[model samples]
Target: MALIQTSLIWVAYAVAVVLLLIIATVFVFIYQTPRDRAVSVTTVCIFTMSALLATVLLMPVDIALVSSTSNSAEGRKKDWATPNEIDSIIKTLKIVYYTLYSLDALLCLLVVPFTYFYYEEYDEEATEVGDQTLGTRLWGAFKYTIAFIILVVAIFLIGFFVPYAKQAKNDGRLDLDYFQRLLLQNRGERALSFALGLLMTLGTIIYVLYTGAGLALLPVALIKSAPTVSAPTLAANTASQLEENRERQRQLDGRNEGRENGLESRDRRELEALIREERTLIRRERLAAESSGEDRHWLIKAWIKVEAVFRPLKLIGGLLLLLLALFVFVSMFITAVDKAKNSICGAHCGYILGYLNIFQPINYIFVKSSKVFPIDYILFLLLVLFLFSASVVGIATVGIRFLWITVFKIRKGHTSPQALLMATVMLTLITLAINYSVAMLVAPQYATFGHQTFCDRAPRHPGEQPDCTHNHKAIRPCTEMSKNAVAKDVCTPSVLSTFINGVTIDFPFFGLIMFWAQFAFLGVYLVVFVATLFKTPKMDEDQLDADLEEDEEEGLLASTGKRFGATWQDITGHARTPNYGAAETNGERA
Candidate 1:
């Protein structure tokens, strides 16, 4: 029986890993595929798919932790024909967990970093690899991978190892044995990991909140936003835009071409901008010309129609996703606060999903869901996927948001190889953060869908389709339990609670961080949402209004004073100076 269950678990894992590979391959192919196809697509797929999968190896281990925390595994032990079977299953779980853990260390710390550089070396846009021989490129990527390893080690030292060393009072050893579950052995590492994960998780939260707001509001705004395009001027518009772009490019070339570092820094950036614009207009012109009456091919017309539908569908879907994400955030926030306040569960307390279990009050509706068997599990998985997909979307978009956004000044798009490397590293960190985010989202849906919880079979297996209250706790509190089928010490948590204690196995401080930091993340999210909601959406119109307001606010001499602010002369003399520039050149003509 143990072997059968173990084999089934591995089979499920295999299916999941394959699905992840497909998803990872599609993402990498879209984002990181070499522009210059010197490397085969097949090879890139194989390498990148392997790297992403290898880096993300802790899923099953964490799931096991969740199972243990809920005491579901203890409940499952009753089914074993022999007492040894429980031990056998546990031993198997530990073996698989450590195997993946060690392999993850090997691949994530060593192999994955090189994969990015090796792939990036073939990118024509990455000028750092310009004109280098294959051997030179290979050597550079190797050096880069080493540097990345050193950086990871340094972070490990600061975040985990140093603290662990101090706590253990053993200078030579570090707590690399991460096979812990709610045990307080390596508190330092857990706290630090929790902190780092908290920071990135907040970043992920902001990403989702803002994206959701934008997505929710975009579709209607877009449908109403009609551009004033002249039918006859399509070709003329492209020509003029291209000509203007080239003119700027020509000016930049002439100014910088003679310098030692030709077209470096901002000049290089401006040139690239010009080139991109030129290409965009050229493509637009071709498409516009082709679309003239019968000149448009049937394929082109079909694509155009498809795009019309596809664009709206995408936007609508984003809006729906945003709603779901907001609900998840609220649920998490509630769960955090409840855990911080209550500390431990009593009565029927273990698996609190907070707002995530909206279906609890209406349990009668889904009371029969347990009877659905595999269907119930499937539905539960779908809910998990939806919540998790939101987190993935947030991680994916966070880097892009940071890349493009600014506070006081406009940010130039990241076009340099250095920026590329930085983004990749950020991607790496956020990928780690996804585990925490997804874990936070996943625990709740089990209650919603009426899937089995620890209390489901507690105290002599109360009917299969148990209510949230019964499923949340056994017949009595752990302290009061006597002659019960469930373990005496394992307190079953209430399904009504948003977050269960001991849920976050590795990052034990996660609940506390979430509770304290709720203000910061939620505050930022609210600020962004409110500002976006009330503020003008049209940039050009806002700019025009501001310009007109500025012109109106100007006085004869005060306009100059406002422009440059109070000058040294004005400050020193205590004299309200007239427009200094205007006064200096007052009746002069060029």
Candidate 2:
């Protein structure tokens, strides 16, 4: 029965793999169209999906391998695959996932510049089609070559600062003893992180409150500063708008009138339809031409602005992201190495695999609160996972918006103040919400999953499975095992114990590394966005006034606050007396 079940699992895995291949083929077909300008985003999405699909497929294979054991006739245990073979396969799969994730991140970074350059090139070509000198073209090509060289150099410099090669010296293995000692040596770092996070949180709250109050008072300020327009000017402006609307109405009526002038009813209907279709086609062509012209104009302006503004930021942003990625990569390598050396079941190796898991919300907070707020370890882990999902999904929502902007050529909206404000609010909210959620939901459920899963296992021996609870579950769970624990019991509170200022604490090394890495990425994003906001242009006075007027006309807001006399009249349901001579003349004119 077991053998049959294992065979079914393998078959299911094969079917899933085949389905993934078919989906990939479909993506390939979609990518082949020349007019499919969304290819970049589509390609990245498909590749990331494929990576996730592959990871899911490999998980079942791992489970099957772990569960497949045979009983021998001589009363000895046998296995289908050796531990070494299974470990090798698991490690290889892990490497594949890690590489896919890194590539996905790199693609995200690359898309911004690539999209900018693409539109710039398109604009240049559109301009140079009819009248471009050879010298000018050559100069353009020369500049492009220089820019490409600089981009390559920039990427290299960014990668150089990552320290990956240094960490890889010990085959990416993390020495727990060395790490613990380093923690003691660098006590100031942990304190600084906590201090910075707390300060930032308070600062953000204060800023929000202050800003909200200011916005609430803005209408009063606007009312006080409202400009006065003469009655004749207002009337003239209103008359001009009315005249424009009348003209449009006349044109629409003329079309209807023309349609009614036909002889036969069927012929009249068909002819009217044909004429309407022709008019529609012409209108569409005109609109498309105007749109293309506008796009070309804006593309040139945007490209110039991008160069003047964001080009300077590229090096700084790249370096920051690079450093953060490397930090995460090193931490992941360390975790994997520790798990392998300890011979823990790969399924229970930390919370998740690769640097992607670092983006999860679970972190040092759980470790810090576990002692003070106790609960089931399994429940705590699940809560952490849930928070991780929510936070990552929120971040991805913003990311997808960016992808859409690039793919759809929505460059004009990219640097708007409203967009920047929204981005800031969303990011800040996500950060705060995740921290609070983890504290409230996950922290209270914290138990000794780490110790139970790692410590209470049997000693390593030849031809024997490692002390993995999942592999050999005759050993009691951590909760039961730790209850009767003595000084000699393996069910200790900590898995990788460390000293912080001579105080022993169960150091959540993986969690802290990931948490800091997240902060580093957020820091880079915040700096870049704030800088961009500063660089972006504001609407001129005329445009601002026009927008305000439109909003007021649409009943969105009051143009001006009423005076005290008017307010009193409104409250009392009273009418003000008018000048009799002026009123008599106005009535006669009407």
Candidate 3:
């Protein structure tokens, strides 16, 4: 227990370090790329806020948890923190976590589906940029952002509050129902808020659709827009074309002279056919190369590769989550049945309620001591089988798919070796999380009981006196009976209590361990994923977006202002400033 506690403390420290590193990295990027001021600011704010929230909210929980676990295990009465303090910290953590969870879901709902529509509109040019009003776009963006925020808050209530309310109702320690009542009242308020928010979001969308505008305007207002392409300089292009024609004419003239001199006689029809074929092939290649396409940075390519591999795993995940939910439901059923049987039986075969008699045999075979065929054991075996089967199927399928994706994406120049290296690390971490969760569920049941011993009064004891210091009050012989006996308590208390208490403590810790472990793993994973996917340094080499390069060059002047004490206000003005060069060039093309 001490070792485990110590290990957990270290793990917490590791988590803190990792989170701090992420915060530092975000700030560093913001500092380095003042040109991407809007984007960098948004990124910094989100991450900084998240980190602050985590630190303030989770630190206390960690402290309380460590103290509680250590004191409880050592049987100490001293209080580093009271139970109330611990409970409060945990409650706060849950509230904040769930709130953030709702926001995450809200973002997904708003961004992903709408993004598809936005792209479709952009591709078709359904709404001409020149025709759209700036005020309309800004108003639409603001309305939707507000609506999403409100709707997310409402979602937080519906998803988290109702369930927590139900749970609190069962908590015997809560001396008053006042808090629970408050929660119910708040739920109603949140529901109302949610409705209003939904209406606002929908209303804005409808108005936009009616006005023949696109949701593309909303994201464009929020996130930085892609650099617009400018027209080619005609003078330079014409000059280059003329030069190329002159060179071609010279080559033709040389070929004619050679033929006239009879030094190089050839089939004229075949030569013309070959020249036509060559020109057609060159034209096709040039067209393919000139097609408008987004840049594929290393990280984006890596993601594309990873997505191809894990696309099928979405179905696998759904199946696994469904199976896990079923398992939990069955476990709950077993628990309820056990509780009911125990209550009616009263730790002995006392007169059970008549209605409950139907399940008496089930109680006996499963919950009770005696079993004819170990039906309960068979249930345990089935659980094991299912767990093993599900894990094996998931891991094997994902691994095989990853290998295929790696090979395929590498061939397509979409995945780098470094990306695969990071991917392998991710897989290992995922495996650890999955296996650890499963083991936590199953390991306690088969834990070793304390050393065997016979009480002094028992026969065939070989004269070896049992150490019943912890079990003396509970130990009794089988023959010692009365009209009713509490058969459940007829065990060595030392061993039984140790086993029972350990398992009990492990149950909640399972969730706690899984939470923080995944938290740390994901922090690392996101850093690697994002660094590989986006970021300017890694992307510049691709040269996929010529306009993007120009934007960066223009941004250099804005970034320089940062060194001379320019504020966000200054950066904002700079972003709004039009690039007359680009606009004039585009006008020429028009």
TM-score of each: 0.52, 0.32, 0.29
TM-score of decoy 3: 0.29
Q: For candidate 2, report its TM-score.
A: 0.32
lDDT of 1 by residue, 325-374 (tens): 46555655655554445433211222223323233221222223433333
- After superposition on all C-alphas, the RMSD of every candidate to the true structure, in Å, is 15.9, 19.6, 20.7
Which runs of model 2 end up more than 4 angstroms from their true locations? 1-81, 109-112, 124-462, 465-590
lDDT of each: 0.40, 0.33, 0.31
Q: TM-score winner among the candidates?
A: 1
List candidate 1 stretches off by more than 4 Å: 1-12, 32-78, 81-83, 87-112, 115-133, 154-181, 184-319, 345-428, 441-485, 488-519, 529-590
> On residues 209-255, what C-alpha lDDT tens digit does candidate 3 reach at each position?
21111111111111222212211121223234334444554565566
Query: Stretches of candidate 3 above 4 Å error?
Result: 1-69, 72-78, 95-99, 102-106, 109-134, 142-590
Candidate 2 local distance difference test against the native: 0.33
- Measure candidate 1: CA RMSD: 15.9
- Which of the numbered candidates is closest to the native, going by highest lDDT? 1
In candidate 2, list every pair of residues with a backbone clash. none
